[model samples]
Target: MPASISMDENMGFQYGVSRPGLNPPIQFGNGFYGAGSGLIRGGLGAYGKKICGSSSQYVQSNISKYFSDPQYYFQVNSHYVGNKLKIILFPFLHRGHWTRMTEPVGGRLSYNPPITDIHAPDLYIPFMTFATYLVLAGISLGLSGKFSPEAINWQFVKGMVGWLLQVMLLKASLSSLGGGEAPLLDMIAYTGYTFTGLCVAVLGRITLSYAYYLIIIWTSMCSGIFLAKTIKITLYAEINSYDANMHHYLLLAFPRNSNPKPRDSQNRRETISLIQKCKQFHQVPPIHAKIIRYFQVQDPFVVFELLRLCSNLNSIDHATKIFQQIQTPNVYLYTALINGFVSTGFCLDAIRVYCRMDNESVSPDNYAVTSVLKACGFGLALEEGRGVHAQVLKLGLSSNRSVRMKLLNLYGKCGEFEHARRVFDEMPDRDVVASTVMITSFADYGLIEEAIGVFNRARSKDTVC
Candidate 1:
């Protein structure tokens, strides 16, 4: 029988005897326990391994098992099946363990799935539908004389096409979930779908036709659903990888085992070299520039990293001074400063930075808008928030989803339910974000019934909760 080890409050492991009848190598981590059993099982008192002769066989068997019994299927077998499917679909999902798992139990036997070309039918269908709609809408607009021949900038169209290509490149680099191995292709399909939908909407809005607006809205809803699902899958994949890594580390450092430590050797040298390269490429320069011919073309991402490093080193003054030197401070820069100040309970400083943005005519974007609104929500400066709202409207940014959401939140904070409702009613599209903002607003203001009503309405509209 495999021994069971449980950790104490201090994370010290204690061994427990497992009965012979019980599965061995039963692993427990965080709050969950799993047992392995069956032909591949080591009688290790761990989780049972669901066996499959082939990948297709595995998928078919698992699906049958799941749909056949709803209650016990997911409860008992879903995790293994889901994990296996993830591996089959995205072989690189678990880099280290995948290699180990595929290796033979004892001999040199190797098990690997055949490389198969996969295409996304779900993506293709929506893409084709949206493309058809765009073509029709564009033709309609052209015939209606809404698109003036001289007004049409082929350059802008070219730029938009370039933007689509850039988006595909970005999606591929980011390892977007739905795209998987064919991220570039997947992103291209998604971009086509999004472009067509937006084009149709633009055509409709230009023509001021309600029917076109209705079509645009319907298409948007469908697109949003697909986007949300893609995001969900990506997030799920990330979380699973994180959990697997944690488990692998825990297993390696099992009871009384010292955590692995790094050594100053060739490996360390390689690591340091990599870190320096990353800093050079990805790190932002210090906010301060000492009249260098031109500021080093550092990555904007480096700024956050530098700030984090400064914070860790307790060089608050240095961080602050660097932040002050930013030429065109964006929402991210302001938010970082605001967050640092708020964390240190320097509410006044946070407010001052917010005011500075307006004074400098920088025009606070969504992040800045949200931070200030949050400060108001906490009853720090309701009057200041109201002023920001006026500025937002004057900038003609009130219609932006982010700004509107912030405004909705601010109105709720001020206990102005009517104002919040007006903002909600004014939104061109009542998306999940809009609905959530309203629901959260009601909940925050102790309006339970109103929150529930908002939730019900959202559900009725098929806005996934």
Candidate 2:
């Protein structure tokens, strides 16, 4: 028989005393409690395991999404390391393309890694250099008879702090400079590059002692130059509005030298020399402007140099004014002005300059023709490009490889695939580059099948395709 049970206020359950004719009261055993608790514990453990696993995966995915793939930054090879080191120490000497290489993957453009592209940033050098810096500091401490584990640990801490500060500073700078959307890993890699120069400075201090000052200054200068140039090309490439101002900042950062007088009497030689010097030093355009104003130089050669410099600086207006100063512009001077306008992205102005040259009866050279063709391509001036092509044939430049290539590019960019194909067929030497260009142009216009046909029919094939 069951025992009579009543609820108690303090205790959850209480067994009442057995009444007459009632069977012995049932006992509440420990097994009951143990089984009940075990059920709850097992359920909770399974739930908690599932929650932890899902939450950890969520956090990891979020981190990866925010920071990008860290593996991309660490993919460096020996050749890439060597070239990267060279760039860090002598940025001005690097003449290769500053933009990263991209390939089509899953129908989207993905940038190649440092192993495949020299322009792509990496983390390997910076990490190694930081370690080297710490080691060098330890060596210095040993030389001074102050070596200790505590001292080495402190150095490590300090180095880490400095690295963090540099990263923060670079991230902030880029944010304010209109590159806030840049990847976090890229910023880290770029800022870490400072350690390379830091390592060099420490080594110099340990070795030379006396020239430590000089070495530090030089290394600092090189590092500044490297960062400025790299940021200029990589981050600022698309910020057209900020490009001129960025050039100004870079101009200020470059080292200065005393001005030199023009060498010859006519000042043509000296004027050209001065322009070259300014170009080399990255002197401000105003300095050249002042020179042009003071010297009142009129030589076509000097004017051409001035136009070239202005073009390089993307100052097409200044280049136009310089061109106006030439009363009777020669072919070279016209070509220089056209090239400047083309380079500065003033495609319409370049076309107008080409027209003006034609009106002035200045014959277009191969360079002038090519520059005008490029301008037409960029401006999408199909009719203008056709006119330039006619001029090319009339001037007997059709056989010129560069001219032919420009013609092919102009037609392809304008979506004139038939013309482009005709030009390709007529090419006496359809090398890999020309064929690749044709195939790429077709592919760009969504002619994948055509591209494949061109590839199959090609006389020679290479990996570049």
TM-score of every candidate relative to the true structure:
0.33, 0.42
Number of the top TM-score candidate:
2
The candidate 1 region of ten consecutive residues with least summed lDDT is: 1-10
Q: What is the lDDT of residue 347 in candidate 1?
A: 39
Q: Report how far residue 398 has shifted in candidate 2, in Å.
A: 0.7
Report the C-alpha lDDT of model 1 over 257-294, residue by residue, as the tens digit. Answer: 34333333554344333334432211212122211112
Q: Hey, what RMSD does candidate 1 come out at?
A: 28.3
Model-by-model lDDT, in order?
A: 0.46, 0.66
Off by over 4 Å in 2: 1-266, 279-296, 459-465
RMSD of each candidate relative to the true structure = 28.3, 28.1
Model 1, CA-based lDDT: 0.46
Looking at candidate 1, what is the lDDT of residue 80?
A: 41
